[model samples]
Target: MRAPLLCALLLLAGLQACVQAFYLPGVAPQDFKRKDVIYLKVNKLSSIKNQLPYEYYSLPYCRPEKIVQSAENLGEVLRGDRIENSLYQIQMRVDEQCKVLCRIDALSGAQTKAFKAKIEDDYRVNMILDNLPVAMVKMRKDEKSNSLVKLYERGFPVGFTATTSGGQPEVKFFLHNHLRFTILYHKDEITDLARIVGFEVEPFSVKHTYETPWDKVSPTLNTCNPGRATFVTHDMPPQPVKEGEEVIFTYDVRFVASDIRWASRWDTYLLMIDDQIHWFSIINSVMIVLFLTGMVAMIIVRTLHRDITKYNQLESGEDAQEETGWKLVHGDVFRPPANASLLATFVGTGVQLFGMAMVTMLFALLGFLSPANRGGLMTAMLMMFVFMGLFAGYFSARLYKSFRGEEWKKTTMRTALLFPGVCFGIFFCLNILIWGQKSSGAVPFGTLFALCFLWFGISVPLVFIGSYFGYKKPAPEDPVRTNKIPRQIPDQPWYMNPVFSCLVGGVLPFGAVFIELFFILTSMWLHQFYYLFGFLTLVFIILLVTCAEITIVLCYFQLCSEDYHWWWRAYFTSGSSALYLFAYSAFYFYSKLDITKTVPMLMYFGYMSMISIGFFCLTGTMGFYACYIFVRQIYGAVKID
Candidate 1:
């Protein structure tokens, strides 16, 4: 069973890599004709202070193009691929003239009434400052900043100059700045998408002097540009239009040509990782690993050797004495834990999580999962977790049976539902909050149903099958026979207490990865791109090794102190890192984030709890197995009558 499971995991990982590799674009660009229709996309707009993201297309004033094609796939919409054609039918023109290309009527009775309703409902105005065009552009590398700048769409900043010509206020519009755009080639055809490379938005005023006696004054208009040359009209006063009042808004569009190809678009989003920080983290983890290695070696070489030598010497002498320390508690060491069935279930689920994490990291390290492949990481993790249900069921059943548990069916059910149910419940509540905020981050109803289907249809059945096979096999034989009567545990030292040792043991594992944790938290909350999978994979390995080694050393100490209750202690010793992780998250929220809104803050902690739970399971499982192996090895080695 072990051999087959290992082979299946390797094969699945290889297949996933191959699938990802197949989707990668070829070096040579392919020729294709450009589609005449261009679609507009919307994203959440936020304030620098409040940091709350509200719906962008919530108002009826600027009606976004509705998605007409494949409406069934909620996953596609969640990924932000749903595009709609703009309501204003302005034709794309490539000329230098500032011509009146199109005129849009300001008032259509029904649409205007709907817009008024939306306004009364507190929908935000469609301002150019907050909107970003959903177009991908390959950026040219800048040597000065050593970073890639997105070639975004540019908008001309319009300013109104008012003058009294005939005893009335006459307002004339002026373009404050000019934009130079570039054309990109897609295969053999030229795309209508124009890239904006350079722009200037300095505050300047224009003054005109007439020959006739007239007073003239100019107020400076400060044009604000948000990196992409987009301008906002939110500062402009509302123009009230009476019945049949005409409002004319003129815009100047420009286009330039470039030789950049479309195949390299993914390069623009690539984030260059800081190698220094990563290397420093690696060195720190290595130092911890070395420290742990020394400790484990000392236990095996000095303490274990001395104990074995003294025991042998006493037995060979004229007067034979009973074994002391760890050997004294041999009969009760293998005794079944209280609520053994529940422990088995948790350990089983933890094993499943551990396997999923390992395989996912392995795939990411090998370049099978990258940010370039959208939703790849989540998709990979979800699939791997579901498929690993077999391990969860098998291990739980085996452990429970070995503990002389009779309720295999109940144990298997708990193994399948316990941890996963907790995660889903938290996620569902967070999703409800997102839905109330009307944020695009909310998962749709269909997607939720699909997730349920995946969990119940695929994962649950696999667990049952694994449990069935596990129950067919007899319970494993223990080297040290458990005593019929339970042995009384002696009072332990303060440092040797389960709680104190667990708290201390957790620090080393958390320290091994906390440096990397800063970068990960920054990526999550600060919206920075994280592409350092290789470094992350290394940190994960170091964390696993540290957890196992530390737990084993701690378990040996507890046993040497004649404490046989090492089951929960081993699990908590490494799992307590989750508590530290939550504490760090609280510190990070207060110190780093500018989020003032109650909803976003609640969502942050809600998600963090789920993450901490997963980390607890993964680390706890590693420690338990390490301690299990160490206990079995030393006890099995000693000869018993």
Candidate 2:
């Protein structure tokens, strides 16, 4: 079991290292450049009386490809409108519910040819669907289209899931990327209040009431009935209609982008308008950073200063062990960590990792870096780990000294490198598996080499430096001399065991992230967009706090239970958050994912292991530091000579 567990952990660590190394960038451009393009949509009309009244619901959107195409066409037009540009294309699918279109379906090839010819002559730049008063507008003719610009500016992920009743139930997922609306109505009713504001002419129908500068009613009405005595409209906005029990005017729109990075890839050619939601996320992120930074700073400075001062002022060479601080149970300080030895290693590794993560986040909040920089996380983490190695070395040396063990050298060596080595090995094994599958998700060989260089060139040396400092920090000044003979600990019930308390400490932090993990998985596997960085950052903060608090509570309980060997116990108590993370990952896979094969399963587990390593390190660090502080405070206040 130990061997298998070790192999599994090493494999996971290696894969995570690669992902951190190779994942591409996911960020918007820094500069604002506007590219415009027209948006068009078509629908079949049920009836076309003398002068058909149509209302269009116009919303701003951007499509990069369309914008690029428009730019190319405009370039050609400027040279000379000699070239007839094929500006738009539409492919309609008639599903089983559409019975009337079957006659045209039988002559599909002929109808398609005829439709193409008719569109070339009559439609020109944009197409007309069936015999509707609404004519799609050509907003711009450019290669890089700023069609989804509005949605992008809003920062709303341009996708929504629609549910409908079938034999069981059916879900239609729509990603709103490109489509826009145009309305056409009679000019005579344009100024009328009933016509502009729109009132029910019939139970299922509406008449326009007002006229606006952008509204044009004549040209639109002329397109449907050419020779009829009907006025045409140029541009009209889509109007919202609501009546008792009628679906008079409703059209579904969607955007189709070639790839996820459509906006930035095309640069000048295609740009999405800023969506309102995106603006909101930016504002929210700024506020959250300010709030969290302030709170964290206050706690660290005020509470820690008071606690440290109180610890240092206690009289020595007295009955200081009777005091209420953490040092009261000095004998119980070097206990083996809870759970398995493997878990203990992870917790130890996590302490260093936490410092790295906190620093990186703070730096990001300060605007020195943004997520848009591809490989930024990997670079930051690599640098952080190198610096953290010093902490690992120092902490390990101090703890080993406090244990008064003869094998301090061995302990320091293992503490400095063993856990990181294990994680790296795990990550490498998983990468091999990914490579075998020929998945795009796999890290390339070159990236792997870079990662190795980063680890050796940066992290390894830092670990040695850190260990030296840690060894130098002085074994926490024990206030009271240890008795020549060790004190015997009283046996406690199972509930009071380090194992049980560590197990309990994993719950709250895990709870905070379970739901969020579902969306993260969708982003990784299903290729859905996830722009909830603000939520994610908040959850990250909550997870840290919850893990720290729970671990502190458990550590205090174990200390009170007379377990002096808490060096490892404190590490594992919070480190157990990894188990919760792993469990949640499994639940998300089985319950939330629509995975169908062994490859995806393997991939999921492989990636999950990487995540587990990070959480393990983060939570473990929190517990260790908390316990370390508590133990030092108690010992510092005691009387020793």
**Candidate 1 C-alpha lDDT tens digits along 379-477:** 667767877888888988888888888999999999889888998998888788877877666777878887887688767777777787787789878
Error at 189, model 2, angstroms: 34
Tens-place lDDT per residue, model 2, 1-641, is 65335434543554354344333222322221112132233211111110111111111111123332211111111111121112232222111110110001022344334323222222111122221112222234443563432111111122334466868786443322222322211222243211111001101111222222312222222212224532223232212211121111112222222222323322211122223434454445445445544554554466445645655575565544545534445554544333333343344466677777776666556543432232344455665665566566556566555554545456555765676677677767766765565433355576667667756765565555555565666665554555555656668779977778778766655655666665666555442334445556666776666655555556556665666666666777767878988887888777766555565466568668877877777777776776677666555554433
Candidate 2 Cα RMSD (Å): 16.7
Quantify all predictions' global Cα lDDT against the true fold: 0.63, 0.45
Work out how many backbone clashes candidate 1 has. 1
TM-score of 1: 0.74
Clashing pairs in 1: 181-256
- What's the CA error at residue 209 for candidate 2, in Å? 45
Instruction: Give the runs in model 1 whose Cα sits over 4 Å from its true position.
Output: 1-55, 59-65, 68-268, 312-323
Model 2 TM-score relative to the real fold: 0.51
